[model samples]
Target: MSHRFRKPVNIMPTPTIDLAGPVAGIDTHTDTHTVAIVTETGKHLATDTFPTTSNGYQQVTEFLSAYSVVAAGIEGTNSYGAGLTRHLIGHGHVVFEVLRPTRALRRRDGKSDPVDALAAARQVLTGQALSIPKDTTGPVESLRMLQITRHQLVATAAKLLTLIKSLLVTAPVTVRQRYATMTTTTLVMTLSRCRPPADVTDPVNGTLTSLKSLATTYNMLRAQCDELDNKITDLVEVINPAMTQIFGCRAVTAAELLVSLGENPQRIRSQAALAHLWGVAPIPASSGRTNRHRLNRGGDRQANAALHRIVLVRMRHDERTRDYVQRRIKEGLSKKEIMRCLKRAIVREIYQVLCLGRPVRQSSGLRSDEFRALRSKKGLSQTQVAKKLGCAPARISDIETGKRRLSELKLTYEEFLKTA
Candidate 1:
């Protein structure tokens, strides 16, 4: 059954404190922290600066205890502001991660660290910062950390690949061209079939040796990354089983979704809040009948990358995705419009994963076991798959590799009678 997306508001939160007297707002940086303490009567109780470390945390807590602070306002609790927020919570302080105002707020009041801190204090003072969610606690933190590390590794892999390609051009005899597409096993096999060219000059020999060392280092890093990725994927399966069940979802997509969910579901008010946080939520730009908002150019770029992986995978692997997007194209929707729809649907899935405490969608029939069974029973040769599907053998090879999907074709006969 299809599901409706929900942005769940905590229907129940015990407001234990009336927040009398004073409130403190904190702004943190890598090196230092600035905090503003203001009383109910608009008097400056105290403004203190502390180093952003364990010592600073101690000092901040001592300052809070002096005034018996009702609550704290902290800027960017999920990003730059997170360390302080978590630190304060660890020390038993009720903290609200304050949201920065849009450009309009800046134009009106001006921007400064003191002003930002005071604004955070004011948000708590006025009950304006009630929308923030609490951190999820433990397991989510592991997933988020794994994702951050994986991303770094993947980006490094790309640069390493470029280096490998360059070395291949300059030192072609050291490794065969076929090794370019092969993994370490196949790479060694390809190398074993050839020998280093004797035509190499002394300088070129040194360079080739360096390239070999680089390749060794690259393989080690890649192996380490793969091991970490495996652990992260396994952890995701345990923490959020639904992650393993979603249609068109892969291990990478599941890991990313888990990371984006963070340590707490309560940290986000709803799925729409998440969409906005990730910058997937479209904005209106209506004026004088122009009615066009440009592409979202902000939000957590890393989070968006995770979502993009999901979209690209769906576009390539899931026939349902192709049908939906193709239908949009047939109706003359712009590429951007179709992409927007895909992003929204992904956000909907994200909501399900977080709120329901499920890591992914239900299995339904989207299992590898089922996929393999269908493939075997189809009994369709490569030539038939290519001919009937109106594609070439190489293209058909890619589909089987799971690198691409057969475009504009019916399902193989074993699957055709199974479902639409």
Candidate 2:
């Protein structure tokens, strides 16, 4: 009716609306993965399942791209989601590690791929998941692979050795007597060389044959371990020469630390983070009037073992560390407490070397200035001396300062002189 007298009214076309891209969450499995896409405002847009294969990865990424994925949260970045995490990062998407849903949350929300994936996305959007996945393409990855292989080999050898020992317990008296006084190496060699009788009907012959077979397997595994050890040693020397230079850190120990810390040392936020990661950080157990911290029984046990080894070596041979232990003992600390302290301290020292890239000062009996001059004369950096001696550079400084000796370097005075 208004159109009868009103001037022509202009109608404005609805402006185009632009919504922000969605974030993605992945629930990874061995053979397949469930992916959920959620809008910036927390609305679930879609859910899809894909195979855990190269082509599947490509297809998943493509599907996410269609929805304009801004970021992704992936559960088990170190395990099931490792491949996808790598792919997403390589494609320039910001990726965050989504820890497994807690038992409480799982019970409350129930569980399904889409549910978990949605939860992961929510965690990412809300900043609940903050861990940056490790770069798995570096030398550290190679070291990890080798370390895992070596560890398996070692475990297998131990199991085989145990079986052989059990067999020997019931073995023929002649066989037991022959191996009883022998060392492990000697026994293995002897058993491996035994000429078992061809008569399978005889118990002794059967026992001999079984022993030889076990011994042969043990020897082969040992040989493989040795080869792996050499490879690990070479790789460690190249990856971080400074690691092997620490007084108590051998190639194996250094390799373990490297694996624990990853290639990018900066991934360890701080010395405290490292301590926590290795379970060397004491947990506060104080309640009310009680003031105390208890041993942390979490984190990487392998890393804890590595730190414990360093503490043992230092306690046995490091004068300063020995003095510290004595003082702590005089202060009425128990051995366990002392060990905890030592592990924490050792973690600090290792953190300095690994994370901060600093040389650890050893109590080696040498003047700092003298070591400096000697290093200068030899055209070596603190790192070079440490690498060559398989001890920390700070130890080299200590040796030069006359506060520490060269003995811990596994080198005689003459060898030191030649190297210097």
Candidate 3:
């Protein structure tokens, strides 16, 4: 026997139940959002759909306001739901990130917009989802957009370079022989400067034209990447000069860390949270007589990569790090084990710098008393001094207190005296 299944029908308007101060959940999509409202005690009050636009967002707010919405759970706040989440937050609604429904639950309850929305609301009501969405209205957002653009340009340029090389391999022997021995940089420049014969009927002419075109594009992309690099450097320097001053923390690495942490690094709550966000925190893998921690394979892989780079640089160049590694090696720890420990330590160091806003000290050949005298004589506050010198106030304080070198100040006493 054959069976036919009917599609779910949406014939009912949004139901408004008699309840005060209800909570809402949203299942977000590209063009629309499904909202479910429930009372504080877990009673379903209403379910509605709204378009994903300014007017629709306002209408959803007004609809939720009718029931005195206390809080809301939203799915995909980083993606499809980002706009709605921003809208809801702007209107003072407490928003929680709702996890997607499990496959088991989907099988049992059947899958639909209303069903997922209801599930999200119930998840929030029962305290199942508790993550606060990231604040995307700051410098980090600007950095993220630039990074994404640069990444796309780089990928395109790489593909074009690969294609150019592949074409060179198959071109006429004379053409291939002329280019095969050249270094990549020289080859790109040579191809870009080529004057292809203006004859499409010839294979060599066609190959030369293609190579020249792609090489020109590749050079343009390289120029764009350089421009992006400069912008990223300036922005990172302005956002936190100390960040770039850290060992192995360049503009790209700093930007990745800032993007991973969001604007408010305090949202991390603790060192463990920071470690977990970077995916460097160890996971317990204990069973029976064996007790050990396994490497975490989740969290922001980009942030994890930044941490890895820091570890590798320190291992190769920093004397203290080298000594520590040797000690750990003597204690029977493998290189991987030592690296894990080093990554965790680096995470702690970066967390302090990023979250606490600590400044790095550079050498300025002057005594502590001279530094303090110069600042006081100029009638400048620590903040004013920090601003003039382009360092952190904490670094200024350390300089004056003899905890840090006076050379740490960007301006030496002689320069400041002259400016005064």
lDDT of each: 0.67, 0.80, 0.81
TM-score of each candidate structure, all chains considered together: 0.71, 0.80, 0.79
How many backbone clashes does every candidate have? 8, 21, 4
* Residue 116 accuracy (lDDT) in model 1: 74
Per residue, candidate 3 scores C-alpha lDDT tens digits across 340-367 of: 8888877767877887886664324455
- Which parts of model 2 are misplaced by more than 4 Å? 1-21, 285-292, 364-420
Candidate with best lDDT: 3
Better of 2 and 3 by TM-score: 2
Provide the lowest-lDDT 10-residue window in model 2.
1-10
Candidate 2's displacement at residue 157, Å, is 0.9
Model 1 Cα lDDT, one tens digit per residue, 1-420? 112333322322333446677888887677777899988766778888888788888888998899888788887777666777788888888877666755887799998777777877877777654544447467777777777787788778668667766767666553435455777555533433444455557655555555565666667668878988898878877777676666656676776666665656655656777777677765555489665555566766767877787788788887667766887798888877787778877877767776656545332233323444555577656676567656676765554554443432323422442642
Error of 2 at 57 (Å): 0.9
Worst window of 10 by summed lDDT in candidate 1: 1-10
